[model samples]
Target: MPDNEETLVDVRSLHHRLVRINRVLRLAGSGSGLSAGTAAALWSITQHAPLRLSRLAEIESVSTPAISRIVTSLESMGYVERRADPDDARARLLYPTDAGRDVMSTARNARVLRLAEALDRLEPADRDMVERAFEVLSDALVPPEA
Candidate 1:
């Protein structure tokens, strides 16, 4: 090793920059109409349709009030609809409307396009290596609960 070699601290600075970049990419996508949290809420409901609000809050690990606000916003935008639960009259079942599915699909496509373009500029071999590394990183990052 060269004398100039330095320790790979994997410091707080790197973590901060990584987080900032992720946020920037999220904001710079087809999600111009909705905030990030709202978009996440939409995605969650899309994945778990006819889901309950309490369950959604638990899955998202957010306060019930926060999820209610997001659901309210989604309802007003016609992105989601709430109906009485068939199993429980006191509870409600939430589902995305056609418009909501359209929005979710658009957002997913935009995010994929942006990421693909960014990786496309790299050499094919390098891209493959990075992709593999990302898979490993993803596996490592998943929490036990996930």
Candidate 2:
């Protein structure tokens, strides 16, 4: 078994690699023509719709003001819209318009195509190894059955 220090090093390396992969994929998908922040914020809003600005900020790990700016940009693009929060008159909820979903779909397809191109270059054995590794990682990341 690996020592604690070895385990830490492995985990840190994995984190950095994942971050780099995300960065590369973000750059690859240009169909939306959105800044990274705006794209991420829009994707999150779609995943969890009727989201509040505060909640979006929390999810994005950004200050409310910063997220507000991204949302404003999205609004200008006609990708997102703000509506009154019936439960709280003081707050507004964010929803992705039809255009936003279309943008996301285009972006997603571009990123996947990029990844597939890279995967296609791998040797059969190497590709199998990647698939097995992903399965292990996926299982490890999931919570145990209740």
Candidate 3:
């Protein structure tokens, strides 16, 4: 087995490569006319709809004001809606609209297609190794419930 130092170096290298890959994918898939922040906000809302603004901010690790602005822009674009929170009359819950889901879906598909094309260029064994590596990493990040 590799030593801890060797594993750390490999992990750091993988992290840097993944970051670059994500940036390229984002640029290639940014046809929805949304900034990265806005797109991420929309995706987050879709995943956890009916979320409070403050909660969304916490989940996204952004300030409430930042989330508020993004929500406002999405609302104005008809991609998201603010509905009254039944539990709190003064509070509003954010939900993604059909348009928002469509936009996110399209953007995700574009990015995946671009990635698929790149992966297709790799040797089958190399591609298989990449796929298995991702599976292992994903399992490590979020292990299945016992």
Candidate 4:
């Protein structure tokens, strides 16, 4: 078991990482239709291929109204479309429109470019470690069920 000092240091390091990631995400997501949670929603929609509104709300761990508001915002921006669910006429499914897909593609490219620029000065080994670390972090944040 780690000592108290070691545990505190580890916690502080994790908090710092979270804060930095949040700040970067806020910067990356600003002026875009996709914040971190919304981006996760979009990503899930793509992966699941026409997920329902209630399901999406559950996945995002937000209220139905919150998902509705996000979807409404996306719909207004022409990034997402809601169609009646075939299985359940009472429910609506969400999917990305072509414009929405374009938005995702452009944002992905921007993130690549931004991270690439930041990594330019790093040692190659450090950069590779960062890449691996991102994979681990992504896996932790988005579980298999999620």
The candidate scoring highest on lDDT is 3
> In candidate 3, which residue ranges exceed 4 Å CA deviation?
1-8, 143-146
User: What is the number of residue pairs that collide in model 2?
Assistant: 0
Per-residue error at 107 for model 1, in Å? 1.0
Point out where model 2 deviates above 4 Å.
1-16, 141-146
Q: Please, what is the whole-model Cα lDDT of each candidate in the order they appear?
A: 0.85, 0.92, 0.95, 0.78
Q: What's the candidate order when arranged by decreasing TM-score?
A: 3, 1, 2, 4
Q: Pairs clashing in candidate 3?
A: none
lDDT by residue for model 2 (11-98), tens: 9999899899888888888757898889999999999999999999999999999999999999999999999999999889999999
Pitting candidate 1 against candidate 4, the one with the higher TM-score is: 1
Tens-digit lDDT track of model 4 for 14-124: 889878966774566444656777777776666675888889888888999998888888888887888998998898888889888877777667766666677898999
Model 4 poorest ten-residue lDDT run? 25-34
Worst-scoring 10-residue span by lDDT in model 2:
24-33
TM-score of each: 0.85, 0.82, 0.88, 0.76
Best by TM-score: 3
- Candidate 4, 14: how far from true, in Å? 3.1
TM-score for candidate 4, residues paired by index: 0.76
The pairs that clash in candidate 2 are: none
